[model samples]
Target: NLCSKNKINPLIGSAGVSAVPMAARVSNKVGLESDAQNFLLMHAMGPNVAGVIGSAIAAGVMLKYVLAM
Candidate 1:
């Protein structure tokens, strides 16, 4: 809904946090369904990787504090 209102690609949000390449591939597939020329895999991958890194960092921080206790 937000993507539709903001005119942003829904794939960015959908592919940001899980399944990494799989989500990007799914987004690319959906984009291709709409327009064969609209290739979005690369774009989706950017946020996907960033999300994974951010999640990893957060997990590390949480684990560090948990272990200290």
Candidate 2:
């Protein structure tokens, strides 16, 4: 939604999952299919990497609390 509002392809934004570079590659491939010059890999990767790290941190926190309980 943020990407859509900002005028970026939603596909790229959605690629920001915990899957990392694979998702980014898929986004890039899809973008290239639409337009040869649509380079979205690097842009998508930014969010992808962050998502992985964030997910890891979140999981750690959840586990810590669960184990404590």
Candidate 3:
């Protein structure tokens, strides 16, 4: 819904910590529906993993800041 409204790729839009490989799998499945050759699982991993690590780093930074206050 949000991806369609924003004109974003489903795989890219769905990349996140909780969603992770599940979202990538869904993207690949949907892509295969449209085109049998489509395989997005690996491609989606970069963003998915990055989102997880980035969130952890962000949380750490936020925690440090809050603790300093």
Candidate 4:
């Protein structure tokens, strides 16, 4: 459950952050439609797979920091 929750949370956050700016710029420049904007947002987030990768990277950094201390 924890992993599932972690996975969803980061993915949502990434998508939200990437999509908001993307939507604004895209809407202003090209007048993209809703579905197209959603697609761009999804692709910009680098997929659900990236969330696990990010988590691993974060854990590695933390581990290194702990060991250094």
Candidate 5:
């Protein structure tokens, strides 16, 4: 519920101007094949093992920041 609210509310607030498509366009301009670009996006953003790893890395960064403080 919270995730949906956060995700939808932002899109509602910023309708028609999202970074996602722009990022994809820039990625495409970089000469990546469509399939390779999509695979890279999945590795970065997909709800799978790689996303879990990203979350873990983010958590570690937060933990380090807190410990430093």
Candidate 6:
């Protein structure tokens, strides 16, 4: 819903799939396809890294909660 509201593809998470620099490279590659000068590797990586961190924290919290049940 948020992505649609902002006109962003909900499938954007694919860029963070591997959590590797290659993912960033792929991001730039995809952007280049749209516009040769458009580079999004660095910018996308910011959120990719943040997502990895957030996912780790979320996983930890879920583990704790599930174990407590």
Cα TM-score per model: 0.81, 0.84, 0.71, 0.35, 0.33, 0.65
Question: What order do candidates take by TM-score, descending?
Answer: 2, 1, 3, 6, 4, 5
Listed per model in order, the count of residue pairs whose N, CA or C atoms clash below 3 Å is: 0, 0, 0, 0, 0, 0
lDDT digits (tens) for residues 1-69 of candidate 6: 654556553224656654766777777788788878876777767767877788899899999999999
**lDDT of each residue in 1-69, candidate 2, tens digit only:** 553556667776778799967999998998999999899888999999999999999999999999999
Better of 1 and 5 by lDDT: 1
In candidate 3, what are the lDDT values of residues 1-69, reduced to their tens digit?
Answer: 654556545555575554677867777788888888877778777787888888889999999999999
lDDT of 4 by residue, 1-69 (tens): 555645332223434332444533443333234343443444434543465566678899999999999
- Superposition-based RMSD of candidate 5 using all C-alpha atoms, in angstroms: 12.3
Q: 8-36, model 1: which lDDT tens digit per residue?
A: 77767778875778988898999999988
* lDDT of candidates 1 onward, in order: 0.86, 0.87, 0.75, 0.47, 0.43, 0.72
lDDT sort, best first: 2, 1, 3, 6, 4, 5
**How many collisions between residues are there in candidate 6?**
0
lDDT tens readout by residue for model 5, 1-69: 555645322222222223544443443434345344333333222233443566678899999999999
lDDT of 3 at 41: 77
Say which candidate scores most in TM-score.
2
lDDT of model 5 at position 57: 86
Q: lDDT of model 1 at residue 45?
A: 93
In terms of lDDT, the poorest run of 10 residues in model 1 is 1-10
lDDT of 5 at 15: 20
Q: Any runs in candidate 5 off by more than 4 Å, and if so which?
A: 1-47
State in Å the error of residue 31, model 2. Answer: 0.2
Off by over 4 Å in 2: 1-6
| Better model by lDDT: candidate 1 vs candidate 3 | 1
lDDT of 2 at 55: 97
